[model samples]
Target chain A: MLCGAGRDRDVLTQQLQRLGIVPVVVDAMSEPVAQEPCDLVFIDVDVGRHSPALGGGVDIPQDRPVLALIGSDVPSAVEWVIEQGACGYLVKPIRGTGILASLVIACHVFEERTTSTRTISELRHRLKARQLVCSAAIRIIDVFGIGEDEAFHVLKIGSMERRTTVEDLAAMIVSGELSVQALGSDVEARRLRV
Target chain B: MKSVVPIGILFSTQGPYGTVSRAMRDGAMLALEEVNADDRFDFRLEPHVQDPEGVPAAYLSCAQRLLREEGIKHVVGCYTSSSRKEIIPSFEKHDALLWYPSHYEGFETNDNVIYTGAAPNHHVLPLMDYVLRHVGRDIYCVGSNYVWAWENHRIVRELTQVSGGRILGERYLQVHDCDVDRIIDEILDRRPSFVLNMLIGESSYAFYRAFAEARRSHEALHDTVIGSCTLCEPELAEIGASACGGHLSSSVYFSTVETRVNQAFRDAYRRRFGERAVPCADAEASYNTVHLLARALTGTTPSEIEAVKRSLYGVAFAAPQGQVSVDSENNHSFLVPRLGVSRSDGTFDIVRESAEPVRPDPYLVWVDGTGVWASWNGRRRELTNRPRLRVIR
Candidate 1:
C-alpha cells in the first residue's frame, strides 16, 4: 500500500489483511509512487495530499493496479483521483466490506488490460516478420527469375539448413549479407561440379 | 437468564403504502413475540418502534434516533427502497445493521444492511418468463413514477427485447396520484397482451379499479390481464372485488403457498393479529428477519455488530415461504419464487412455485435459466422487426 501514516491507512491495511492480502506499505508522500514489487497499490489521497511529492507531481504507476482510498466523495477530489489513474476506489473511512470488491475489480481490470496489450504487441511482431519475409521473397523472385512461391520455398530450405527462422534468413538475403543463388540447389550443385 | 437487547423497528405504517407496511410491521412483531416466548435463545430482543410516517426525511431522523440516541445496533425496518437508501448511510455511520424487508429492484449490497426480501432474479426475471410464455409477446406497462417502476421497466424491456416480445405502451405517475384513467385508456386502445403494473400502494389500487370499470363489459379483459411484481393479498383487498381477480403476481411468498410450515405460520399470524391478518412477501420477510436476528444472537452479545454479522453467516431459517437463507457475502436472502393469480376473495391461488430456494443474485451474476433467451437458437435478429410501442405519460 503506497499510502502515508493515518487512521485511514491503518484501517486499509487491516482490511487487506482480513482479505488475506498482505500489503507492503510505502509512504507515497515521502516516497515516490513508482514500479513497486507488489500485486496492487492502495494510495491514500487524503494523507498524500499533504505531501507535494504525491499531491503535485508523482503519477500512480500503471505497472500494477491502483485502488484509491478516498476520504471524500467531493466531485473534484474524486475526479482528481480518477485523473491520477485509479482503476477502482474505496470511500473512507475504510471498511472491510468494500475492500475485497474494489481489490478484485482493480486487479481484474489491470490484468485484462495487460493481456490485451501483450496480445497487440505479439500481433505487431508477427506482422513485421511477415513484411520482412515478403520483401525478401519479392527480391529473390526478381533476381532468380523464379515465382514468388518458389522463392519462398528456397528461403525455407536455406532457413532450415542454417537453423534460422525464414524471416531471419530473408533479412540476411535482403541486407545482402547472404546471396539468393547460394540458397538454390541447382546453383549449389553446379558450383560443386566446377 | 436471558440477556435483553434493544432493537429498532422503523417502518411507515401510515404512509401511501401503509396497508402493506402495517402488515410487515405486524409480521415482525409476531416473530418477536414468538421469539420472546421461545426458550431456545439465551437472549431477548426489545424493540424500539419508530414510524417514519411514510415521509422520506422522517426515515433519516428515525434511523438516526434509533442508532445514535437509542444506541441500538440492529434495526428491522424500511418497506420501500427509497426509505432503505435514506437510512443506509446513517446505519453505516453508526455501524448498525438495518433489516430491510421488501421485494425491490436489485443492484445493491451493503455490509450495514441485511436484505431479508426478494431480489430481482428471484422475482421479476422469473415473472418475465411466465408473462412471455403464458401472456403474449406484446405488453403495456403502468407504474408509479419511482425508482422501483423505472428499474423494473428497464429489466422488463431488456427481457422482452431479447425474447422477440414487444412492449406496446409504458406510463408512470406520481405516488398516490390515481390519474391512471388516461393510461388505462391508452392500454385498451393499444390492446397489448398484458399490463405489467409497477405502481405501488393507492395508485396501484386506483389503477386496478379504473381498469376494471373501463373494461367491465369487455369479454377479452379475461385474457388481457395485468401482471405485477408488487401485488399481494393485502393490495388486492385494497383493490376491492370488482377489479381484483384475474391479475397475476410474482412474489417469494403468497398467503396461499401450500406447505405445512406456511399453514402453521399463517394460522399463528392470524391468531396473533386476528383473522383479517393476511401475510404477504414483505410480511414474511420481516418475520424471517426477527427469527434470523434471534438465531444470530444465540450465544453472541447483540451489542457487537461484527459478532452478530459473523453469527448470521450461513444461517438458514425454515421460513413460511420455504427454506430461506442469507447469502453471507451480500446479506441478501435465498427465496423461492412463486407465481399466483388473484382470486375473487382478494387472496391468491398459487399456480406455480420453485421446487427449491434460489440463491440471491442482487448483482444479477446469474442469468435466469427460465428466460426466453435460454430457449432461443443462436440466430441474430433485429429488435426493430418486433412490434414497437410508445411510452405514454
Candidate 2:
C-alpha cells in the first residue's frame, strides 16, 4: 500500500530502506513493468496523471504480483490495470501502517490466483441462503403492502431482533414459524414515525 | 467473460442538494464499465440506476424494481443511509449484496452488506474532537429526521455532554421537504456558537440555503460557526458559490488534498467528466469496489453467487481514495478521515486529516467502543448493522 507520501521518490526510498523491499514508483505517463530482485514494488501512478499499467513504470519480478495503487472507487482504472496484468490494486490514501496489512492481503490474492480453489459447501450455502431470503421477502411483500426492499428489511430486522441470520429468519418467516410480533411491532413503529 | 451479474445501484439526482448524486454516479459508472470489462464477466454486468427523485419511498421502490423486475443481485450505491436502510431487508431477502459507499452513524451491524464509508470513529468522532478543541463550547444539532441524522445526533449529544460542551438545542425535519423556516427560526433563537448539521437528502441544499440566507453561512457564523458532517462539494454545487465557501465539513476524501494520488484522480475526472466531477471519499470507495471485485473474479468465473461474494474477502486495490482493505472479519473498508473546508468552486481544501487511515470498525467491537453493543447515553438497545437500513411505513 503506497500511502501518505507526497513524492513517489521519497515514499519509495523509505519503504525500500526500512523494510528492505524493492520499490518502483509508477508514473501515469508510461507502461508498467515488474522490477527484478524486489519482493514488492509500490506503484505511484497518480503523480503523473496516468494509469500504472499504461505507465510501464513498475518493474517487479515476473513471478511476483504487480501491486498497483489505484483509487478506491475507480473501477474503470482498476479494470484497466487488471487488463495490463496487475496482480492486485491497493486503494490510495491508505493508512501509513495499513501498507503492511495491504501487503499481507495482496500476497493472499496472489497465492489464491495460482492455487486450488472453490468448495461445494460454499456454493450450496449461498444458493440456499439466497432462496430463503428471497422467498421470505416475497412472503413479507405478500403479507404486507410493501416493496421487496421493505420485505427484505423486515426479514433482516426480524433476524437481528431474533438474534439469527437472515437465512434462518427467512426460513422461519416462510415456515410461518417465526413469531409475527417483531414484524408487527416494526410496522407499527414505522407507521407512527411517518 | 462467461458470468454476468446484473448490479443495481440506487442514488439521488441533481434536484437540490448539489450534484453529489450525479458526480457519484459518474464515478460509479466509470467503475461499472471497468468491472464489466473483465473477461470473466462477459455478460457485461449492466448497471440499472434509479433516480428515486430524492424520495425515501422512491428508494424502496427502486430497490424493489431492481430486485424483482430486473433480477439484479448486486446493489452498489445510495446517497442516504435511510434510503439504503429502506432496501437492506430487500437485499437480504434476495440474498444479494449491497456495497454502500457513504459515511454514516454507527449503531448497527449486518452481514449481508459492506460499508465503505467512515463509521463513527473515523467520521463523527474525529469531527467531534476537532469541534471541541478548535470551534467552541455551545451547540445546536440540526438534521433531517431520518436514521442517519437521528442516530448521528444521538451520538453527538452523548459525546458533547461528555466533552464539556453545552447542547443548547436539537431539531429535526423530514429530509429534503422539511419546513426550514421553523428550524431556522429555532437555530437563530438558540444562537449556539456552532451548528452541528447531520442532514442529508434533497433538502440538504435547502437547509444550507436557509442558513446562508439567514446570514449564518459558515463565514458569517464566526463565534457561531456551523460545522457539519455532511454538506460537502455536492451540496455546494446545489447551493452555488456563496453558500459553500469556507463552510466547514468533515469527510474522508476531499478533492483538494495536495498529493500525487489525488492530483491524478482529479485530472482523470476532468478529462473524463470535467473537473467538476471531483471525488469524495465515498466515490473513491465505490470506484475501488469494482476493481477489487474484478481482481477477485480474475482467475475463476463466478458461476455461483457464493463464489462471487466469498471471493471479495481479500481482494486489494490501489484506488484513489487510499489503500483500502476488506476487513477479513466484517468486510467493511478501513478509510482515513479528512476535514474539508468547502471553497466557492465546489471543491474543498483539506483543513484537517486523520494522521492515518482508521481501521474499518463496522461492528464497533473495539474495547471501550460505542455501538448498539455499547451503552448509548446509558441505555441499551439492540442495534443492527444495516447500512442505509430504512424503516418503512
Candidate 3:
C-alpha cells in the first residue's frame, strides 16, 4: 500500500492484517517508486501529487489494482484520483469494516476492466496488421499485374520463404524495403514450366 | 476546600432530532447533579450547556465556544454521528475530551472522545441475529440520510449477506422529511418479513405511524416487524402509542430493565426532570458519560487530558443500563446488549439480554471476523479467534 506514515496507514495495515493480508507499506511522499508486488495498491491520493503514474514516470501494470485512500470528499480530489486510474477508493481514516469489502470489490472490478482493455488492444493490433497486409496485397497487384487472390497468394509465398509473419512482409513491401517485382520474379520462375 | 470543574454540555434540543437530544441532555444533567450531591468526590461539576439545535454547522461553533472560549476540558454531548464528527476536530485541536454518549454506527476511536454507548457489535449485530433467526431472511431497510443510517445499514447488509439472507429493498429519507407514506406503502407491497429502520427523529416517528396506518388495512403486514438498533423510549413517545407497539429495538438500556440500579436511575430522572422526561438508549448513554466523567475527574486534575484519559481506564459505572466501563484500549464502553419490543406506554419490554456485558468491538473486528486487531495500543496483538456461534435470540 502506497501511503504516508501516520494513523491512516497504521489503521489500514491493521485492517489488512485482519483480512489475512499483510501489506507492504510504501513511502508515498518519497522519491518516485514503482508499484510493489501486491494484490492491490492503496495510494494515498492527497500525498501522491508527485507519484510516477501522474507524471508518466513509471507505468503501473494494468493488472495491479489501485485503491485510492482519499480523505476529503472534494470534487477535485475525487476527480484527480479517478484521473489517476484508481479502480476504487477507501475513504480516509481507513475504518476497519469497509477495507476488506473495498479490496474485494475493487480487485474484482479492476481485473474485469484489465481483461477487456487487453482484449481491445489486441484486437486493434490485429486490425492494423490486417490493414497493412491488405495494403501490401494491393501493391503487389499494381507492381505485378495479377488478380486480387493471385496477389495475396504471391505475398503468402514470399512471407513463407522469408520465414517472417505476413504482417512483417507487408510492412517491408509497404516501406519499399522489398520490391514487388523482385518477388514476382520468384513466382514467375516457379510457373515457367506451366 | 472542594475543587470546582466547569463542564460543557453540547446537545441539540431544538432541531430535527431534538426530541431525543432533549432527553439526552436531561439525562446528562441528572447525572451531573447526582455527582455534585454525592460525597464520593471532593469536587463539584458545574455545567455550561449549549444547544446546537441539530444543525451540524452549529456543533462546530458550540463546541469551539465551549472548549476554546469557555475553557472547559471535559464536554459531554452530540447525538448524531455527523454532529459528533463535526465537533471532534475541535476537541482534538483544544486537547480536550468529548464524552460522546450515544449508541452509533461505531467505526471510530479517537483519544479525544470517549464513546459511552453501544457500538455496532453491541446493537446492530445482535439485532440482525434476532431478526434473521425469528424474522424471515428477506429485509427492507429504510433510514434517514446520514452517517448513522448509512453505517448501520452497511453492518446490517454485511450480516444479512453472511447469514444467507437478502435485502429486498433499501431506502433513505432526509432527517426531517415526513413524506414516508410512499415508502411505507412500498414496504407493505414488498412484504419483507422485517424492516430494519435506521431513521432518526421526525422521519422515524413518521415511518412508524405511516407503517401502522398502512398495516391497519393490510393484515399480512402484522407479521412484518420493524427492527431498529436506534429506537428507544423517547422515540417511542414521539411515535405515539398507536404506532409504537410491535417495533423491535436493540439498545444497551430501556426503561423496563428490572434491576434496582435502573429503578434508582428512573426515579432520580423522574424526580429531577419530571415525569414527562422519558429515558431512552442515548439518554442512558449520556447519563453514563456524566457518571463516567465524574468518576474519572475524582482524582485527576480537570485540565490534564492525559490524566483524565488514564483515570477513565478500567473504571466501571453502575449505569442505569448495567455496568458501563470504557475499554482501556479503544475508549468505547463494554455494556450489556438488550433487545426490546416497544410497549404501548412508551416503554420497551426487554426480550433478550446478553448473559454478560459484551466487550465493545467499536471497529467490529470480531463481529465481521476481520481478525485485524486495531493496534490502538501501538503493538499488533494476537487476534482473538472467538468463533461466532449462532445464539438463539
Per-residue error at B86 for model 1, in Å?
Answer: 0.9
TM-scores of chain B alone in all candidate structures, in the order given: 0.93, 0.83, 0.92
**Would you give me the overall lDDT of model 1?**
0.78
Over 4 Å off, model 3: A1-120, A123-194, B368-393
Comparing candidate 1 with candidate 3, which one achieves the higher DockQ? 3
Better-scoring candidate (TM-score), 1 or 2: 1
lDDT of 3 by residue, B1-393 (tens): 778999999998998889889988998998899889998889999999999888777888999999889899999999887677667777888999999888877767888999888887888887787677666789999887656765677677777888898999878787788899878878878888889998888988898888878777787776777888878888877878878886788888889887899998888888888877677788888888999999988778899989988888958888777788889889998888877778777887676776567789887776663211221121221211211110101
Which digits, one per residue and each the tens of the lDDT, describe model 3 over residues A1-194? Answer: 76767667888988888889978876644434464666677787655633242232233445578888875443345666777788889876577878878888888988899889999998887688998899999988887777787777777778888898778899998888987777966567445733
The DockQ assigned to candidate 2 is 0.01
Off by over 4 Å in 2: A1-194, B1-3, B14-18, B36-44, B216-221, B300-303, B363-393
Q: Counting only residues 3 or more apart in sequence or on different chains, how many pairs clash (N, Cα, C under 3 Å) in candidate 1?
A: 0
Position B120, candidate 1: lDDT: 84
Ranking by DockQ: 3, 1, 2
* Residue-level lDDT tens digits of model 2 in B1-393: 256666676777655432666666777777777666655554566678878866656777888898788877777778766566667777777777677877766544556677776777767766676676666768888776545665567667777787788888777655456567787878777777678887665566677677777764333343456677776665677677666665667777777766687787778667777745667665666676666666655554434446665777766665665666677566677676667666777777565655445676543456232232122222122212211111110
Model 1 lDDT per residue over B1-393, tens place:
888989899888897999889988988999999999998877778989999888877988898899899999999998887678657878888888998888888777889989889988878887788778666889888787656776788778877887788989878777778888788778777888779999999999998888777766564554576789989988888888777877778888999887899999999989998888788888898999999999998888787888988888857899998888888888898888877778767788676677778789887777743652233322222222111111111
Q: What is the C-alpha lDDT of each candidate?
A: 0.78, 0.62, 0.78
Docking class of 2: incorrect
Question: Candidate 1 clashing pairs?
Answer: none
Span of ten consecutive residues with least summed lDDT in model 3 chain B: B383-392
- Per-residue CA lDDT of model 2 for A1-194, tens digit only, reads 23324433454467545766655543333433332245655554333223132232333344665566653222233444565455665544333455666677777776676563355555677686898778778766776677776666777767777798788887787688875544887655555654
Better of 1 and 3 by TM-score: 3
Measured with DockQ on alpha carbons, how good is candidate 3? 0.04
